[model samples]
Target: MTNSEWRMTAKRDKVLSVSAPVPPEQSIAWPRGKGRALLPLANNSDETIRLHLRGEDPDSACQFGFSLPGEANKSSGSVTLELSPGQVLSLPVSITPPPPSLLGLAPQTYHFTFTVINLSQKERAWTVMGRLKSKPIIGPGLLGVTGICLIALFVPLYRFIENRENREDAFSATPAAEASEAGALWPLLNRGVEQSAPQTPQLAPPDLESLTYEAMFKEVGAAYNLDWRMLAAMAYQESYLDPMAVGALQEMGLMQIMPATWNVWAPKAGVSDPFDPYSNLQVSATYQVYLREYFSGKGHPGNKWMLAAYNWGPDNALQVIESGADWGDVPLHVRRYVLKIMQTDSHPVLSDPRLQESVGGVRE
Candidate 1:
């Protein structure tokens, strides 16, 4: 009998296991006005597995479909794929939001399911639930009010500066002796002016060397449905939660994501600032999910390869794996990076509750 395992690649570095006979239901949120999001499904079994997917409601406001590479017929209601042993088939499931006219101003929900059958004809199914919500739009009235507030705040400061300059010009018009007397008073006037000057508010700098962003790391992990400990471990290894940290290779932010990779994932993650703590964590999590999927699809245990790929680049990691080298045989720097992340004493991010539960309260 061939043993079979199933996994779903949702984000970049994350994969959710699917139980046999009946997998647990999963939920996702979709923002309105955005294009369809891609969900990757994989089969990690020794026996060939066939998949059949369909939606719960045919006349629902939302639309569902599948994209299979090399297959001429890509249909929505049903699609079939014969996945070989240890082979992963990426089934792209697309969700089309309902028109604003039909959806109105409220959020909506949609449902779908996928059924899988193995060589022995044992069948199992999994459910996908989605909530469709529209992005908030700023109205012209709010913009106008904000503009008026800015004018009210800055106009007086502008006039105050102008008046001060005019007064200085008048002072220069005084007689030499009067100017000399004025010069004696200049010190007092300068003191007064300095005391009266408005101070610009400054932002407090980030505590880079500290584990202050532990909550943020856990939040991003939960958002991506990943183990928080893994995310924390990676962040601690990369930048110790320092958003301003920069690697020698031009890698930026806490997770040390490459510029090129950030550019590809920023839009998908709704991140405008790569250096923001939340944005950095979000992008890094997404990239990790992709890495997990890619390595798992290639028939390798994703943990070690995923870490190596994150540190040494995906191509290099793949090359090392293809060469049949163990994790110790990987490049020295990559090996060290992977080991550091897997080590618990390296940082305090593992103390978080989510991470503790993920690793089963064990520290290694």
Candidate 2:
């Protein structure tokens, strides 16, 4: 052909066309929902291009969608599309109504052609490339990434500094936890069920007769859901047998009944004396049960930390448990104290002893 005649052929060829997957590729595994197929321009001539999709079937009719990478899509259908040689036109496609049955069926695929039409006189022969990209690669090596990281770190540090400044002026007295005899923080010391604490030498049995222990048992059983043996153990740890015995802190009665605890629970239980041994044991048992429920609900395993909270308070207990401070690491006295509570296995400790009692003392 003459050089001038060559212009039209090159221009026609510049309008690109392709049967996707070529032939023999009938189906394309498209991601569920909306997706796009890339139609790359190949005319090579630096020319403006106009491209559109022309479907073979009547169902394939929609505006030609344009986007970079895999984002271009107008609509999904089987069709032949026309395009300028040096121009790339994206076709939008969607996969709906998942295959009816995979049984005895070959995998499904889709094939389509995109045509690039050169709107202006450009290079001799334009070549187009098609790529189906699901997502664009985000390169962090680019600018602004360092700024994003700095912002993330600064927020938490700012919050911490603000809280510290606020605390300087507001926290004047002994912290809320230590200000009172019935310190809300008293639960921190009770180790509860966590056996991770190091065991201390067991407390010696108290001088009290079995009858006195039994009486202590009945009182705690009547007033609290806690096992009587646990109360008995605490009583031994606190008094050894001295009904009137007091601790170094002057804690009195069974379970080292703290004067603070007495003032708190006595009136609630309608008791006139916090020093009443029966009343004291009963209150302590009730407190233990409350702690058990509280710990179990916070998604923490076991009542160990919960009991510790009872002795110290919730905030202290959370610090110990959440910070991975194993109860075993605490002092021996603390460890032994928690272990004693867990060791009580006698009557009333089994919860519904009737079930065990009926099974000839077999434990569930």
Compared with the true structure, all predictions reach lDDT values of: 0.53, 0.42
**Tens-digit lDDT string for candidate 2 (29-48):** 22222222222233334443
Candidate maximizing lDDT: 1
The window of 10 residues in a row where model 2 has the poorest summed lDDT is 355-364
TM-score of each: 0.39, 0.34
Runs in model 1 lying further than 4 Å from the true structure: 1-212, 344-364
What pairs collide in candidate 1? 11-289, 12-288, 12-289, 12-290, 13-288, 13-289, 13-290, 14-289
**TM match of model 1 to true structure:** 0.39
lDDT of 1 at 91: 45
Q: Give the alpha carbon lDDT tens digit for every residue of 1-364 in model 1.
A: 1112122312221222232211112112232232222333555655666755554344565565665665443536566666666654334444455543322233344444343333234445554433333322433433555555566546555655565577688764335644454344445445544654433211222333343455555566676766676778887778765554656554666688776687677656655344556666777877777888899998875577887888888998888778887677787888877777767564466664443232211110
Model 2's alpha-carbon lDDT is 0.42
